[model samples]
Target chain A: MPGHGAAYFGKLAFGLVVMFAILAGLQAAPRRSRKIIIAFFTFLGGLYFALEFFYPAPSGENFLTGYQPLVAGLGAVIGSFAIGLGVFSLVQLHLRTLSRLRPGWGYSIVLLVSFVAMTVFGLMNEYSPNATVIPTVGGLWQSQNAHGMFRFLFSGGLSNLGSATFSIIAFYIASAAYRAFRLRSIEATLLMAAALIVMVGSVSFGTALTAGIHPKLTDGSENPWANLRIENIAQWLLMEVNTPAQRGILFGLTLGLLATSLRYWLSLERGAYFDKEL
Target chain B: MQHASENWWVSGLVVLLSLIIIGKVLSAQRGRVPFIRRIPGLNAIDEAVGRATEMGRPVMMVPGISGLDVVTLQALSIFSYVARAVARFGNKSIMATIDPIVTGVAEETLRDAYADAGRPELFEEGDVRYLTGQQFAFATGVAGILIREKVAASFLFGAFYAESLIFAEVGQQVGAIQVAGTTQTNQIPFLIAACDYVVIGDEFYAASAYLSRDPTLLGSIVGQDYCKLLLLGIILIGIISTSLLTLIHGGPVAHLLHTLVDFLKVK
Candidate 1:
């Protein structure tokens, strides 16, 4: 970004054209060979990351480490093209719905308008000089600039909608807890007891109830019985019990991820997606 | 993560485990596949598809909000299995993706799946949708689909964050039979509470192999179990050594253990 000029733009354009040509060629290639070719590239990419991680270096950085960012940047650029395809797909669907006056055509209108407004403002905000905060006499027109419009749509509209939608989850949680906390089985009872302890221990009332259970008793002797305090029980459950269970799950999760990666890196996964042809 | 050169002692364990996993995979391919217990969620997803087929409604799948990572890829594999089932029953399947590349890949995956089922026309581009790449926006869009289509079944797989509850709750509201799998431990509780079936932790990864019964995957899972045993052995050894040393309090063996542990630790 710092050294960009005519030469960089030219090279970028040339690289894009080369990439496009290669992709087109791959598309035109035989189906069986295409799978092999794709798998080969996938292996190369995975190998780079794998070695970068596993290979030891005297200076604490492997040879491939420095190229990691560049590779990631290239991947991001290619991914942006996929976004282009997604946009095309979305727009095509909405256009069909609007033309046919589908049942939910009104929602389609809202989507398209928002899409266009956000895209226009977002692009302008990115390319244009920073919009100066203009002192204005009009209240509603205070943020009429590209920055303001984008902020109005993004933070004010999208953010609020998202937050409100997410807020509904608290109610869902309450309902779910009501159903899950029933004393139906041993597991359920244990869960309920733990939940009750955690809930009570987290609050002031529970602590107040155990206020007399001081770490040191009135006679100035160590009070081992203080461990029975509600807060202490809750702290033990969270730190000693809950954390260990979470770690246990994480251990399995990490190993599972390792196995899945090996399956993909080796192209050993068998399915229509992976073994469509050869 | 420190470089292996800086922490070769720790890296040695990782490398050894990886070799075992690879070995198991190769061994499985040679007809020595290990057994994987039934993942109840697999049947649930299949049954959900069948229910949707009976109801004449589409089955919706949200493959998390991540990009083209291993998590999303596995989610896509499961989606492919669901698509194949849907195609077989002359039912429709919908996929809402939060990543553009995943949307493209999901489209191709479903197209191939439908073709495999000899129902190429059933694979509509409209069904494999590219919802907004934004997380909450995708949630809102997917919620709309769940409510409007009243899909009989919804499958939520992959790494979900805060929006996990939104999808499950909405599907529940629509009386959709939901099968959710996620490696996010925190999200698992919410999923378990709301969905009819939920896969937690590493079980999320096993969902694919259970559905496809691929020998390679079963072997990899067995290798993972072996690695788990290896970890348990190491942990037990560490606990015993530390306890004995604590009791003895200062000896050559304790000193050696301390040195070895310090060496393995990140500098």
Candidate 2:
């Protein structure tokens, strides 16, 4: 469809009608048949990706290969619209809370105020003619400015608040590490030792402590003795031990993901959501 | 010898994995079912819910801060079982989601679970909430919920980032028994440190199977183990052969092995 035109509106109307019609039809269908319908569509989508991916085409591209972006974009498009649905939910919840004078009604007021402020300032900052770049200051029209409010709200308010929240993690980490690294068990002891080594290895003081231990001799030959250096030991532990351990977990994780994905694509997944009578 | 992403190896592996999983599923339907191993995190969920019931406090679940992906879906699936248990005990279950669709799906899942448990009236509209999509905002919001509601148990299952620790710490402060499960390995340590029980590795993916004890799902988990075994076997052979070939220096067999490995690295 055209981006903007009478034709675009006509096509958009038709699409909406068609979507609603399909939804109504699905809703009206018998319960058992609905499962089959879901299974069929799921299989079709899965088959497309499977063939497009697995088929070693002589031409270097399968027939269904070109639509990959479009398929992915469809997901993005749906997700973008889903944000609206999320906003609506937030608004409804807050509005209801406010109307009922709930215990946290004050927080609801703050939330609604912030939501409206962000959405308005964000839209205006993006589309307003006077919303010039701070340094560049180049645009077609330089009319009224919503840019100051937008910047203040986003950078001065939301970003700083987010940063403050993120900074709190440092304190929490200390608390958690204190609990985890306590000398209670052998495993905890080893974990503490390892954490200590990794932490020290990451600092300049650690490097300074082991600066006398050179990796190379005066004649530019290998110095085997340097392997005992603190930094070197830390590097060895991370590369030789930590990496292999992570890889082992990764192997299991990848295989599990593959199996689960296969179950989903084939519509053979059972239990909870999948098996629930829709 | 060759880049893994430039060949058909992945396709072959995917097909094999699919065959194995589907075969197990069908076999399970035919009366042969596999036994699932013990997962302490899953068992802890029941204890958490029971604790909430006894304390007259609500059970809380955060289905991740991400959109409706496979990870979130898995989290929600686990939550479904949790919801059922809460329903049976006549305790409130609060689910906070960062994704709008997750909130919607979780609401439906909770409703179904309640209906299944013969406690449809226990379901509440305000229980399933959509917090902000922004990361820390959702974290703070959930933390506020934990503090305000004084929940007896907290279930954090999904893809979590830095805010995971925030949840864990807040749950700790409120004296909530926390059970956390995530595929993200980096977050596992923090969860282990703060949570009463931590579900790590593939166990997160295996949660639904553990909870429901569904025959087909159990079979699929078994198949995953078999697939992992096959992978280990291949890796072992490769390592041994490579070591031997290094000493040999040059040979047709070594060259052939190298080519096979390269070709198997699917593009």
Candidate 3:
């Protein structure tokens, strides 16, 4: 294990250096490693999950639960860096755009100004304890108000805008379905019929349609088939038919994903991760 | 919620099936094979890229909001093929990735694809850009790219969420030839609504086999279907036996069916 540790650290340093070097090379020199690092990571990620499941735990300690601390720390670090990278990229892009004064350059200027202001206020609130004293640039980092503004801007502005845009789907769906649901051909008719049935069947209206049908203790009097509860019929169709089709498709997809993953992880993917031919 | 013994049986079956598939594919690779069914959506990629090339426009590929998940990586695999085709035909591709890790991989994918096509000089690191981790920000950035660049064809595939509709709508508005696919059941409605060609659920996985028409891939696909058929057969038997027993009121068949169900009962 100690021997592996030395190799591991060496690999880590080598990998990190290679990462920066490759990033630099990407901009300067077009040369790249022949190896599939993405596939390597993908395989390692899969292995982590596989090991977590297949590897049994010893007595007195749980497997995943015990590793929570390590996992959480790593996740936090990764998450922070991701955020930082986004901010950095945004800043750089906007700054360049503003300097060049490209077409619609004003938008970039607005973006940069808003982003910088928000970030400054965010930092101020993080470090500031008191709001009354307007200290130097460093003091703003200590202001609670600044932090509150960042939360408000993020939660109120960006979050709301995103949600509102997403919610517009309701209108889009209604419009699209109306236009496309026209019965022009047999296939279209069949699709419409299926859609209508499935839509009704999944809702409470479908169940209510067959509320008259009762499950009687004595079935000698009348046949249950005569009732033909739509909801029950829908449930039958879903369980007997739709579910099977879905399961089949899901199973095929699962296998495809597995095979594709194996290909990538093993670096067998052609025309990917290397440009030897080129 | 199943018992450990039951889990073992399922696992064993999976391993057995996998081995059989591997063996079959290996054998087929060393020989000729049968014809595989064509997938229209995947077949359209070449024409889509060609149209973009003719117009002197870039092709945009959005791998959805999925990170390095299996579905995302599968999308990446398909993207590799698409990118190579684009590079070969002297077309440009811009991949707007939501995941940094995926962006990195996508960059490599494009790089390798260009290299494969003998056009490494055209590969641009800036093309494989990471937009944002947030779902909407990623969607907005991709939409921005589509509108600003006036990309000719957009390929949306992977695990999309709320932003699926937004992305699809933007692509639609751009008048770009859009081919969208996803396994996300809820988002399928949106994709089906806006995309010119939509790959629903498992159809996304069939891209490689469909596009390449490689026998090994096709054989594996068929093998997968065979497994699915077997599972379906078992479930059908279960349902039929259960229904018949229930209909018959009470008999030996009913008792036998009940016992069988109990014996195979899962949590």
Candidate 4:
């Protein structure tokens, strides 16, 4: 039992060392060799998923299926590394801007300060105990300090800023829609008309306008001619017309995805990534 | 396993199509260059880069918010060509990605492009950046870069969602020559509305091939078309058979139509 923790730490150290060694080797390799290594690994990784999907296993319990969770765990690990790299890149760029006293260096300073503040408070919030055994007050606020600071930063600061940023889309949509809905051609006019109908039909006004379109049936059924209602017309346009168009585009996208996936999996893709000699 | 057995036909079709694509790639590699129609958006890449060079401003390339998927990879391929052009013209180019993995790959791509252009020294590490992974944050960062950097050309290619219009509209406001491409059906209208040139549907996939003009890629495009034609033929047969069965009102034609539908149906 005492050696169990040491063994686990030993394995962790070994893994980290191996990973760094591999990364160093990759960085040291020539460009052509690096690309070949990348391509070969890409093919192998893709082939695993392909086989896992296509191969029929009894009770879906195959070698790849069993290893699927491991693969996903590895992906998560890599994703964590990517996040670290992203943060590092951000900090590096901002620090360079600040040191150089660039035109927007003041903004960079603010960004760095915010980044550090958020990260520190976030970590504190995560690690701090939930029990309010030690209550500390700052100024007029009575406090559960760490959790309160994080909650204020996240809910009040981050959420509000995010919402403000997202709200910019309303103005953008207005401008974009105005330009798009311009009556430059017959097609544009028809588009605008359809847009109007759909817009109105979704509200009570359009339904009220067509409220009198009830038709009697011999079998005492609901009105068959109710399809002529503005709401019904808009529904038909969306379901029959818009849906079909979207489906057609989706079909094209699917085929395109398949073709592109094949090209990458086979390493037959023609680009700077693939065209280079190995 | 039972479900797999029921869906065997789907797998068969996928394998068959993949084989056809591989065959076309091989045949084209053996010196058979297929003719590909000009993709206007792809053709405009040079013009866009040239405009940026003339205006003495950097070109901005955003690979959308999607991670390192095939779409983003394809976008990077196009970015390689654009970066090469920018390198040759002695103009700066910036690539902003929301994913760090994409940023790493994009940096390599820009480095390779500059190397190919015989200007490896000109490659700037600061140019290709990993803007925040958050959607709106990434959009805002890119928008700031577009306006602050005063980019002359904007290239938006890859998978996008709501942020497509924001980037396109911001580029429009900056008076950049925008060439956007995406397979995102919902975002295509926004791109078309805001961009000067738009690559729609599968054209986004064909961009690398169109830009590179490689035989293998061109052949793959041709093979995709052949598959499309095959699909069209099958659709036509289904339609005609269905129509005939409807007109006959349940007979031998109906039986044949039922068989055809069953054969095509999944599970």
lDDT of 2 by residue, A1-278 (tens): 21557897898788668766877999999977887898788778778776676665666666677788988876675565566777787889889989999888999999999998888878777667266434433675444457887878889998899999999999999999899999999999999998888889889998788888889999999999899888888998899998888788887778778777787777777765557463
Off by over 4 Å in 4: A1-11, A30-32, A58-61, A129-139, A215-227, B1-6, B249-252
Point out the higher-scoring one by lDDT: 2 or 3: 2
Q: Pick the candidate with the highest DockQ.
A: 1
Q: lDDT (CA) for every model shown?
A: 0.86, 0.84, 0.70, 0.84
lDDT string, candidate 1, B1-267, tens digits: 457777676678888988999999899989997788887878877688888988988899999988999999988888888889989999988889888898889998999889988999988879888988778888889999998888899999998999998899889989999999998898988898889998888888887778777888888888999999999987776777667767766778778878755653446
Better of 2 and 4 by DockQ: 4
For candidate 2, what is the interface RMSD?
Answer: 3.3
Writing each residue's lDDT as its tens digit, candidate 3 over A1-278 gives 12235787898688668766865664664334324444455567656655554454444234554665775575565554455565565566666767888766786776677677666766665666235333346745643455566766778777897787667777667766775677978966876876776678778887677667765536457656634767666666667877766766576667776666555554444434422332
Q: For candidate 4, what's the RMSD?
A: 3.2
Return the clash pairs for model 1, or none.
none
Every model's DockQ = 0.70, 0.52, 0.36, 0.55
| Worst window of 10 by summed lDDT in candidate 2 chain B | B1-10
Question: What's model 2's overall lDDT?
Answer: 0.84
Q: How would the candidate models be sorted by lDDT, starting from the highest? A: 1, 4, 2, 3
Comparing 2 and 4 by TM-score, which wins?
A: 4
Comparing candidate 1 with candidate 4, which one achieves the higher lDDT?
A: 1
Q: Any runs in candidate 2 off by more than 4 Å, and if so which?
A: A1-14, A57-61, A125-144, A216-221, A276-278, B1-5, B251-267
Model 2 CAPRI rating: medium
